[model samples]
Target: MSRDTRAVVEELLRRIAEGDHERTAELFAEQLDWRLDWPADGHPAVPWIRPRSSRADVADHFRSLSAHHVPELNGTSVARILVDGADAVVLGEIVQTVRANGAAYTSPFALHLTVEEGLIIRYHIYEDSLTVARALSA
Candidate 1:
């Protein structure tokens, strides 16, 4: 039986929320194409927000996030999900506390995902970069 694309996405989000990095990586293709809609040079300011091309890189992205921010996973919520065939758009908010200065980084996020053969092939995320930068740099 083929898995529902929506279900696959929801499960991946669940794993992320639970801080199950290993399981989250499992849901991604071997050569995952992950990107944050931000300038590559901004990586110096926000290490987690960078382009990644492999599952290990994806895990490194989250590890960078974990090192820098304390995410309020309970406050994260998906406001909407729109699916078309293998493509999905998720609109949501992520609440986090910058570990450096204890500033809150509550920002809206729009995520685009493409699933193939039950694995996520593309993960493109757009978020409030300015807000996040200010909060983290504070």
Candidate 2:
């Protein structure tokens, strides 16, 4: 039996975590639907990253250090990946070092994804907004 959409999506996320943009982008449907909770701040504000949204939004969110080029994502560990039919939940932890203030913080995140017809239809994210602010201020 072929892997289900959740499996495919998990694999896709793995590729993105390793910085495989091209392959990551290929997994999405023609017009992907993306939603983000973090403010772009001084970086590229792509509110809705569609048709392969998660890949770009993630990359931009990491790279956009603004005033201080913070430590490039010290470490990230995916805690869980659960698929309930077409919907999936991904929980992970991210640690980063702030360049300007020389501070570090670890934040937990949760991503809810819905895939249909082998394509990502919806992406919802939940993270600590204050942690992001502190890191940026650093």
Candidate 3:
């Protein structure tokens, strides 16, 4: 028996909210089609905005994100979640204070996830990369 798309996505979100990066990765497939809306050249200051493929990389991404931000000041407000069959889209806004420069940035984000066999195989995140990049800079 396989879980529904909403259930899978909700679990993933819960794990992330709890700051359990390693456990969150368990909700993903061994190999994932992951992408973040950032340039190929990548921002030298933003460490988490990079290509990720395997489940391990997924955990790494979240961990790196947390490492660069002030955890107490980091927050996400999810406006809605839309689900159809195997696809789920999460609309939210993220707020974070950079640990490096004490800079804050807010970015509206759309996360598209495709769940199959209770595991997320497709993960694509669209967010305000420019805002995030600027926040990371001095």
Candidate 4:
């Protein structure tokens, strides 16, 4: 990855850590496209934030998460970023605590993200799938 791509990835991680939602989305171009492979055994079909080529998609995505009131996740830590030109990878951990259905639980996870052109184009996420499933079911 070029240094520029690495810089972009670093900036993205910083923005996310700050929970700057608008700024996080702004980094992606209007013609951007993103893909994510999240563990699906437990969580609902709520969309995780991603870059899309359409502004409408961006609005819809953010609205969906907000409407669901997916509590702001905690313990998000981007460990490192590796850039390979237009493609880059980020290794990190994410922790979320959800209180719904009169129950509560937490999900801790590790992940690898692949980005392109300053936009996340793909994600190969791996984590404790069962733990996440149980938390979401709570």
Q: Pick the candidate with the highest TM-score.
A: 3
Best by lDDT: 3
Q: List the residue pairs that clash in candidate 4.
A: 1-83, 1-84, 1-85, 2-85
TM-score of 1: 0.90
Q: By TM-score, is 3 or 4 better?
A: 3
TM-score of 4: 0.62
Query: Which scores higher on lDDT, 3 or 4?
Result: 3
How many residue pairs clash per model? 0, 2, 0, 4
* Candidate 4, 1-138: lDDT as tens digits: 587777777786676556566776666666544443243222463344333445345445545544433456454566666666677666666565543542333344443445565665544455555554565565
Write down the worst ten-residue block by lDDT for model 4.
Answer: 34-43
Q: What's the lDDT for candidate 4?
A: 0.54
Per-residue lDDT tens digits for candidate 1, residues 7-83, read 88999888888787777888889997777847775546787877788888777777677778766533678999889
lDDT of 3 by residue, 106-131 (tens): 99999999999899999999999999
Looking at model 2, residue 93 earns an lDDT score of 86
What does the lDDT read for residue 48 in candidate 4? 44
What TM-score, computed on C-alpha atoms, does each candidate reach? Answer: 0.90, 0.69, 0.95, 0.62
lDDT of 2 by residue, 13-106 (tens): 7775666555665666655566554554322222222223554554443344322334364676788888888888889986767565677778
Alpha-carbon RMSD, each predicted model: 2.0, 4.8, 1.6, 4.4
Q: Least accurate stretch of 10 residues (summed lDDT) in model 2?
A: 42-51
Local error of candidate 2 at 133, Å?
2.2
